[model samples]
Target: MELRFIEINNLVLHEYTEKIRFQKLITKIEEEGVQKSPIIVTKIDNYYLVLDGAHRYTCLKALKYKYILCQIINSEEYYIDTWQHTISKDDYANHIQILLKNERFSKLDSEKDKDILQINTMNDENTPEPLESYIQFVDCLNKCNSFKRVHKNEYSKDSVKVIYPEVDEELIKLLVNKNRRIPAGISKVNLKCGRILGVSIPLQILNENTFHDIYIDKIMNNIRKYEETIYLYEGMIL
Candidate 1:
């Protein structure tokens, strides 16, 4: 029952403890520095196993992060219960999303620290895009980044129409919600397509059908218009 701080690649993971708060960790790494905290693992003769902090190992590897600090314990006697939790990537990401927004973690203020361990809270104008918008597109980016797939399969209903490779499905829904089809002289109903897309299209020259359809080209165009968005493009499973 000795506590020894150690750092090693995943030689052994308790066969559990997979879903770790990844976004927060990555943000802390990206903001404060990569070596914020070490993980705790169990070590035997030649290989070390994980008792806790499996997410740390998996995420770092996924991000191609080379090194991490870990605490290597020397026995199985310490764990009263084997790490019996099972979590998927989606679950882990969702959990991390919550942690990233948590008040406790949000108040860390790493900017003042010389060592800069973690940016638990940051007020940057550009941060992660809303989960609702980015989730679907994240899938596509992850695939593209992994060189797995360049585009996505079309939805059954929209088979004839091309679904833009990088357009987030949820974002489309959001835009649809924001743009109402209110017919009248009311100001609220004037949420035009050109304005939402941040482009200029003269109303006089444009026909009535122009703003009615939400197409993939328009989505791609909007993304290009907001080229400086911070997290709208993090790669995922699409």
Candidate 2:
């Protein structure tokens, strides 16, 4: 409950696990300064352990800020609910590769061979080759109503193909829905890959009820519509 400024170096991270930070986010903080939200930390064994806001911590550290605004709380006083990603980093990389393989894009041989894929724009003078084509490809995947439905094991399915110019607003809405149905997190999608892909909402952000009240209201209302038979059947009754 007590909000105070703490030195960046004094903060300790979770020893067993860590979260990824976004360079763009760090850059934003540097340009605009840290926003109003205070990072949450708890005092344990004379050290402050970051309960949430790892990215913010990293960003502030990168900016070489001597102090950061934070909320100090007792660990026992707060309950933590952690969410793990269903898709691992390697799985996501493989998915991207599989999607690229099915496309008409050309692969350029780089010095490091960093799995860089390029799109051939020899025919269209106006079309951007690499980055633009990459964005187009990702946008195409996002438009597929079945993309989200596909299981992780099916990423390599031969039929998996990227379609273009068809944007499914409804599918996008479902994919990004803040309701409990879809997990919220910071997305790893970036310009390096030519688009945004995943969501990685921090636990602190998720704790804010107001941040998702509207979506939760809609979800709860939808469930109440079937409240009469919601638990009547276990499996497919028809």
Candidate 3:
């Protein structure tokens, strides 16, 4: 994996971030003075499209950091998946009611399962832009009593599950090209061999204008220092 610092402006975010989460990250980075992990990105034409860590990217940019560390990966090596959303029963009903009033959304006939609902855009004038639809959905979702993104649909009488159509890389790139973004916590990127974490590069180092070579040396040293601790694991990590 390639890890290096690049200009923050060189990156593009494909997902809308949570304001609260972004603030929290800024606070954490300020207190710690180190970036715990590099944001993941894939080069698309002339720009680097963020595949993960949208919150981190925005937080650092908000902090006025000119350079941010990133992990560059191949665009063809990853697949995108959508999260299954669950919310409290009352909130779910309220959300559905809200969608019905908005012409942008169309509620499809659900599966045999009563607790699960399928929702999508109607392709009409009322339909907001691709990014806005996700933003609206997230706004409505956050107002719910209890909302969670799940991998498996666990039937719960107190909660209801909602599913949207899967999105592919082409769609993601298209959204980015159009200056749009999917909402946070919905699009999931599955990368082979997982991601590198806990590198803890200090913020000061990132700000140095002449630290590229030194940064590479430090990274090589870090690789040696952590070699014993790194191991490959198959299956899901909770």
Candidate 4:
């Protein structure tokens, strides 16, 4: 594997499915003055498609860097896959804010003056009426059948379990069946417990199609049971 510094304009992003909402990440990168991970890419039809590290790519792009460090790979030899949080810590409070501002909450009709939900004051026991309604709204979002591929991540033994909202199952099925790529930013939500954030469409790619059923089932089961740990490929192989 050769590490190369390629011009940003030369790379093509195909089937990328993660969002680039990394304000904190960008700040960290600026502070550190270096990127920790080199993006992985494969050349297809003379265009380099990013196989991983789209977030890092966006960060560098936002930083106005002309060239990026990358690990170029032979597409035929290695399979590319992705595992991402449907909802990250940064999205938790934002989702709550969306629910609060949405007009669907009838209970909040009288509180028209209030736009933001004060999450710090609410908990399972002493949650305010408006906040409780927001929690139910988030629950409804998760229970929708339209979302097929969802997963939960419990970071540690004592961490709270977070559930993602429902995503368009048919859309995912179509993408996989057609052997196409999934795009970034499906849907994002937060857990009712206020402990974990949800990511609606955490995508995966495989070199061989043989692992589809096994992995798909794993994601579905994780959504059903809110699994604590999720397995995905993460490494900087030389």
Model 1 C-alpha lDDT per residue in residues 1-238, reported as the tens digit of each score: 1222233443444222213456666665446434433455554445565444555565555555434444445432342221111223343344333444543223233233232212222223254544332333223223221111112221222111111212222333342344311111101111111112222222221123334233324434454334453343445658
Model 3 C-alpha lDDT per residue in residues 74-182, reported as the tens digit of each score: 9667888888877776787876557767766777675685655656754443534443555466567657757677668566656667666567666666677767666
Candidate topping lDDT:
3
Model 2 lDDT tens row, 1-238? 3555566777765411223345766766656543435677767554576656667777666666666556676634554432222233343355444554544444344224233222231123354432344343444333333332233233332233221222122222332232111122312111111111122223333323444445334333543222242233434557
What TM-score would you give candidate 2 relative to the actual structure? Answer: 0.36
Q: For each candidate, how many residue pairs have backbone atoms clashing (under 3 Å)?
A: 9, 11, 0, 8
Worst 10 residues of 2 by lDDT: 188-197
C-alpha lDDT values of all predictions:
0.34, 0.42, 0.73, 0.44
TM-score for predicted model 3 compared with the true structure:
0.73
Which digits, one per residue and each the tens of the lDDT, describe model 4 over residues 1-238?
A: 4455567767755444334356666776777666664577666654566656667777777677766666676634454333333333234343433454544432222123433211221223343332344335444334332322334331322111233222332323333344444445333322122111121211112123444455445434554334576554644565
How large is the C-alpha RMSD of every model relative to the true structure?
A: 28.0, 19.5, 5.2, 17.2
TM-score for candidate 1, residues paired by index: 0.29
Better of 3 and 4 by TM-score: 3
Ranked by lDDT from best down, the candidates are 3, 4, 2, 1
